[model samples]
Target chain A: MLLGKVKGKIISTRKHEKLVGYKLLIVEPYYGHKKDTFIAADKLGAGIGELVLVARDYAVKSGLDKDAPIDALVVGIVDREPEKK
Target chain B: MLLGKVKGKIISTRKHEKLVGYKLLIVEPYYGHKKDTFIAADKLGAGIGELVLVARDYAVKSGLDKDAPIDALVVGIVDREPEKK
Candidate 1:
């Protein structure tokens, strides 16, 4: 799982068929000091600038089709921002 | 996929049974300017400092046991350094 802030949303015209209904959010890491941002699938309605938990790997696919081409997903919107390490 | 140079090997005394024979290499992303390094399973005999390709998510598991706890994998070693974008 990754602690992140939903930075923004992405609009793609051509995407996988399985990704039709999901919103794509740009997530920035809150803990790892990583410079890159991840574009992840969102089904729980996470809004921009919100703190959330992102699940990676196949574990993220259980909520969608098995072959959705999604490597990251917005799993939770934090009730409160957790202390950063 | 990720383009990276193998940083080093990880020696773990206790790991998942499915990961027993696979070498774990530290892969630093060569693109996306990501600061985080990934611990990825390597079955292609990639050596330290070698440029390689890493496949992430469930797509990485096709070469191993599906239930393996591996999310990153060294899929191919580059023949030469490709042009970086």
Candidate 2:
């Protein structure tokens, strides 16, 4: 998983059947001073600018059910700073 | 999948066993007027600011092998504009 900040939401008039009820957010992956922005499927009602944890690969499948059609998903919202380096 | 420009590469001193040889690129997902930036795994040697296609979920497994430890992987680089609306 990677740390990211939700930047904004994406609105699509048409989408895949499996993505109908999920929210799409543009997330900027934050690694210390580095930020790599990307979009992801959000089902946790994460707000803009909220620090979030993004799950990938097997983690994603485990976080959201194994059958979920999600490659990248917002798994958690960070409420406080983790141990600093 | 999403189109993006390869902004830069990420160098990690520590990584999972499967990700050791794969290149990681900070990508910005592009949607015409809307540009959603994010990072992704790039296996195609894509350059910075190059448009590319991202594969998610089952697509990722099909693009790569089934056991590849990638949920979001750069599958292809776009050389021309797709059909506009």
Candidate 3:
């Protein structure tokens, strides 16, 4: 899992039916120099600017009854912020 | 998902009970300068030196009855090798 900051929410009008109730959050990695961001399914009610833990791939389908196309997921909200280098 | 080459198998004598019956394989990324390797749970009977797709995080626990401590999983074995750069 990687540490990330939720940047924003995604609104998709057309998506898989199994993804209907899943919240999509845009995340930026906290420790990397890479500036690109990715979207993650959020079930813990994470908010923008909050530090969260993101998991990737089919692990994204864990805890769901049906399979979805999600490649990333917001697994947890960090209880404390880490010091930056 | 990341493409990886299965380097070897891991033998864990003591692990989580939910992890029993899962095949553990060490993986090396296919397209990176990083030489470090990580272990992934494999269910599709992949073999050493085979190219496979790896999923990370809780997505690793997808399709399992109980949640395991695995952070990675081999979801597929590549049928063809990509052209080398």
Interface RMSD for candidate 1 relative to the native interface: 8.8
Cα lDDT computed for each candidate against the true fold = 0.70, 0.65, 0.69
In the range A16-52, model 1's lDDT, one tens digit per residue, is 3445687776677888644555567788999878998
Q: Which ten residues in a row have the lowest lDDT in candidate 1 chain A?
A: A10-19
Q: Which residue ranges in model 2 land beyond 4 Å of their true spot? A: A32-35, A83-85, B1-54, B57-85
Which candidate do you rate higher for TM-score, 2 or 3?
A: 3
Residue B67 in candidate 3 has what lDDT? 69
Best prediction by lDDT = 1
Q: What tens-digit string does per-residue lDDT give for candidate 3 at A1-85?
A: 8898886665544333445687766577788633335557778999988999987764556745577545677888999999995
Better of 1 and 3 by DockQ: 1
Docking class of 1: incorrect
Scored by Cα lDDT, where does model 2 land? Answer: 0.65
Q: List the residue pairs that clash in candidate 1.
A: none
Residue A18 lDDT in candidate 2: 47
Provide per-model DockQ scores.
0.09, 0.08, 0.06
> What is the CAPRI rating of model 3's predicted complex?
incorrect
